[model samples]
Target: MRSLFGDLRGKIVGKNIKIVFPEGIDERVVRAAARLKFEGLVEPIILGEPAAVRNLLSSFGFADPGITIINPEDYPEYEEMKQKFVELRKGKATLEDADRLLHDVNYFGVMLVQLGLADGMVSGAIHSTAETVRPALQIIKTKPGISRTSGVFLMSRENTHERYIFADCAINIDPSAKELAEIAVNTAETARIFEFDPKVAMLSFSTMGSASAPQVEKVQEATKLAKEMAPDLALDGEMQFDAAFDEITAKIKAPFSPVSGQANIFIFPDLQSGNIGYKIAQRLGMFDAIGPVLQGLNKPVNDLSRGCSADDVYKLAIITAAQAVQE
Candidate 1:
């Protein structure tokens, strides 16, 4: 883990990256911010009252955090940010609506990224995933040609060379064929960041035509579309987990695919499957699940589990900072 983050810091340090933490009142978020500052990982700008943040850090015995605290009620550029939010919404929001929404730290923090005052943002310690994601979807928006944002978890084994990516695990509940294709392409780009030569498998219960069902057809169509989108990418399937993982089974069931028997990236057919699959690998496989890293947004904004420890906040923030550098 030290080596993993050391490599990340080597790439991102001195780039002067700034990461915004919107859940300023959450102790885990604040503790992580303090550690990030102490380590000089990135400049952390926490959203809260200056005094409140100072006092909170003091209570944690971190009296000299040297981090920036921006109070929404007192930010000098509130008017500019509020108006910018309205314009970004393109009539979905009036100035009055923007005024109210920007007061919420998630909205304010996302605006800092939107305005390029911050490189990226991380939240969701105490907020729902939607609470943090809605602002990025509306404000930062997805990258051009990406219809929606997705998430990927980096599954790395300790003391081994094994690392894999699991996608669509935290966003896009029931993606269509087109949406699934987009997730595959986006996940591929993410894999490159971690230096993985992605061999994506579009996972499903059926392996090729071994079974026929509407859900199976969806994975098949998604696989076809993903291939069209990235013709050079090594991916295939509508395959079962066994066919994708076990060499013997892959040869028997899906011998023709370049991805069969050796897939490092797994794109789940839906959020339910994606969510469940990653958790199983994390808890049972004992892999270090380093993220539910948000991707496909124009700027990076990651979500932390509400039950996250300070270490979780610390690591995800590093990952978010790295994402900003990649952008």
Candidate 2:
């Protein structure tokens, strides 16, 4: 099997990034960062204790000049950074409170990005999703024009060049109609990154009022909201998977719809369906599902599945790196 990173590497080489490992000096983090450096894909910075970080890398059989180390305790402006962080959290943080927050891995990662020490960040091997995201929202924040953040995945088949996108699977359990629309718009933008124009299908159990339920209504409202927010997008919804991907079903069920028969992006109604649906496609359909790629942050930050292989970390690093803009 061709490694997923082998494909994405070309898309994001020479990009500089700082990857925060809260787990501190783990072999997977060291080895993957070393691979990123060896491949010239990124400038990898490891944030942890210098001695332990160096020892771990050496033990992992990685020796790369591109690797740099920093310890939060020894960081020149540790106190100043902590002070600024407290100031940024004026309403919610005290000096002691800021000290406690700095002790957290995710907040420290955000502090690194805020200080211009990194173009982007990726953490959360040992942390919960909420722990990782709260820091991003309160510290790194959303980019201009991005109101909310969501999750996306890129599903690619082996024998064919076909790639599909799915969204909000790893975040947003039961997003409101407007939030669902934002998820659709963001997922569409992410699809564009991988060169898909994205004929989006907002999925539901019902197909064009075939069933009357609150769940179906939610999808219908989201579809209308998406059309209003992104007028030029090729999108339609309250559709079934069959109607979205099958020509015959689309012809019979939604003949007038431009997106029904050809959906490059699938937006699920809720986390349960989205997560279950993507896994079914990956396992049964034999496709590589390439992310819980977090979107809508001021600076790009991502989470690893913890069950992730080293190459998985490497590839997401590239994707996250590519999202960064030089300052």
Candidate 3:
């Protein structure tokens, strides 16, 4: 995990990237922002009442943290931001609506990113996934040629430092074949960002027709669509976990598969399996799961688990800045 973040830090340290934290009053967020500022990693823009945020920092022994804090209620550009929000929302939001919505920190922080005052945004330590994502979807939206955003975890082992990508874990309940294919392609791009060769495995309960079911068929179709979408990508599908990861099982079950036995990116069929799979890897396999990193956004905006610690915030902020640099 140290090596992984070291690589990301190398990319972002001198970039002068600014990342917004909406839940600036949260201890974890404040601590992480202070660390980022101290390390010269990224400029941390925290959203809260100025006096309140400074008081919170002083309580933590950082009397002069030097981090930027903006209160939406009294911002000098509040009226201009409202106009921009009205423009971004088209006819869906009037100035009256923007006046109400932009006061919410999540929406306000997202506006900061949308208006290019900040490079990215990270929240959800205190907000739900919906609260963090809904504004992004409505404002930042996805990149061109992508329909919806997905989340992935960069799972790494401790001693060996083996890393892998697990996808669709934090969003999308029951994706269609098209959406699954999109996840596979997007996850492959994310793997490359992390310097992986990106041999992708579309996971399923069946391997080379060993079983038959609707779920298995979905994997099969998704694999085909993914291949068509990225013919250059090293991807194969409808394979069981063992077949994808173990050379011996690959030889027996999928001898001709391009990604068999060497796949580093695993695209799960749905949210249930993706969520459960990463957790099992984290607990029993002892892997360091470093996300549910939101991908396919036009600009980067990541979500933090409510239970996350200060270290988690710091790492995700680095990752978010790295994504901004990549974009």
User: Which numbered prediction scores highest in lDDT against the true structure?
Assistant: 3
Instruction: Itemize residue pairs with steric clashes in candidate 3.
Output: none
Q: Which ten residues in a row are the worst by lDDT in model 1?
A: 1-10
Question: Which pairs clash (backbone N, Cα, C closer than 3 Å) in model 1?
Answer: none
Candidates ranked, most accurate by TM-score first: 3, 1, 2
Residue 134: error of model 1 in Å? 0.2
How many clashing pairs in candidate 1? Answer: 0
Could you give candidate 2's per-residue lDDT for residues 1-327 as a string of tens digits?
Answer: 255445556667654455555555566767778887877878887878878887788777774455778777667877898898987876788888888888786788788887788877776666777888888889887778777789888888868867888888888999999999989988888776666788999999999999999999999999999999999999999899999998988999989899988888999999999999999988999887777888988778887776777767777777787667322
Sort by lDDT, top down from the best: 3, 1, 2
RMSD in angstroms, all models? 1.3, 2.1, 1.0
For every model in order, what is the number of clashing pairs?
0, 0, 0
**What lDDT tens digits, residue by residue, belong to model 1 across residues 203-247?**
999998899999999999999999999999998988998888889
lDDT of each: 0.90, 0.81, 0.92
